[model samples]
Target chain A: MATKKFMFLNRKAPYGTVYALESLEVVLIGAAFEQDVSLAFIGDGVYQIAKNQNTDGIGMKNFSPTYKALGDYEVTKLYVEKESLEARGLTLDDLMDLTWEDEDDDYAEKPSIRLVSAAELAAVFDEQDVVLSF
Target chain B: MKYSIMVNEGPYTHQASDTALHFCKAALEAGHEIFRVFFYHDGVNNGTRFTVPPQDDRNIQQEWSKLASAHDIDLVVCIAAAQRRGIMDADEAKRQGIDGNNIAPGFRISGLGQLIEGGIIADRQLVFGD
Candidate 1:
């Protein structure tokens, strides 16, 4: 069977609605199928991977940490749009730490976040077998 | 190439319809055949024929009517979802003791089998959800 690559573009705020959580679940299921998976954060979706997320105030379970575990599912390609991150004053340091593969060691040691342009990310979607946006 | 589309947002309310329209147009341009367009959840509202927008604006119902009619696309709205939202066809209106059917032509109310069939038959099943 040919390998199927899946791209997930998350576009909702983290706390207001269930779209972010539900989208994470779908990605996990897709990972279980062993499909090649990657994620793109756009709009308010940048919050999904934002650091220092405290859901305790809402009496909700903190799920941001679950994102760090995505690497175990072979879903390590988490691409954040450079403009969105900069607009929110969020550097890679403002996100959870996971083993991110980077070309340079200095940046890799700090927070190995890979940033791509929105146009570049749009082209990435076309390359995938299935592109899901939430 | 044949494609199936799953629409989850209601009409004129969200970007789901707009994205679905874009995807459909792109697929057609790429020489693809659309096998079906399945409406689920709030999406069932798109099948209603009773919609009337401001006269100056582009009518959502009319836009979809033209697309489906011109392409001969199979627009299937989930029956269960439709009933919950009070969107009825002639048969459903009779059974529910409602006044009359308000759903437009070029759209059909059907079971989830349509979804499964589309998923199984089409080369791809593009989903437009909230």
Candidate 2:
């Protein structure tokens, strides 16, 4: 089958619900297929990748570190809605640094998180062949 | 068109499973091909065979099982999600050092990759959850 753009939409707060974690599981598993995979953090989903996540109090595994490993899986393109972040009182600085290595460009590291406005994200959504929401 | 359906919530607690079943029935009746129905998150709960719902209400898991058998549909429960939710098959049960399995007939535990594969193969992919 041809490579289709599978964009996963994360719209919930991490740890509060299992959507963010389960969606990441899909993204990690999707890497082996080598398809064009991308993830969007909209609304409260922006907190999913917020740095300094400590789950010691919650008794749940802190899966926040997994987001960093997504780069190794070749599953880049983490889009954070600018409006969503601001609405949540967060900024790009609040998120973890997620980057992928470019093997052809002397293995240069490039940022994977793209901060897009809701308007710009609409275009991104239109380009997706499949949009899986969580 | 070949279609893939995804259910992201459990039965009774949410309407996603019901909506997905309805969509599948309607799609099949309209003569569209259902490539697969993927259960993820709480949706994996739809594959458990241990449910004992009130007699009057519908048995969502059994309904999915019956629909899959009659239509040769593939019902896949995401293994990771299933494992997390204690929805195990015989193999998984044994692997996890458990005594028995609760997977409904016509359903199998598989990787999330199956969901992505369906997206690639299906002409249309419908998601039935928040």
Best by DockQ: 2
Interface RMSD values for all candidates: 5.5, 1.1
Residue range A1-134, candidate 1, lDDT tens digits: 33577777888888887668756866776777666778889888888888899987898778888888786676878888988988888887877775544445553533324688989887888887767677
Weakest lDDT window of 10 consecutive positions for candidate 2 chain A? A23-32
Best by TM-score: 2
Provide per-model DockQ scores: 0.12, 0.83
At residue A123, what lDDT does model 1 achieve?
82
lDDT of 2 by residue, B1-130 (tens): 8999999999999998998999999999999999999999899999999999999999999999999999999999999889989999999999999999999999999988899999999999999986
Evaluate model 1: give its TM-score.
Answer: 0.58
In candidate 1, the residue pairs with backbone N, CA or C atoms under 3 Å apart (3 or more residues apart, or in different chains) clash, namely none
Model 1 stretches with alpha carbons more than 4 Å out: A100-113, B10-125
Q: How well is candidate 1 docked (DockQ)?
A: 0.12
Off by over 4 Å in 2: none
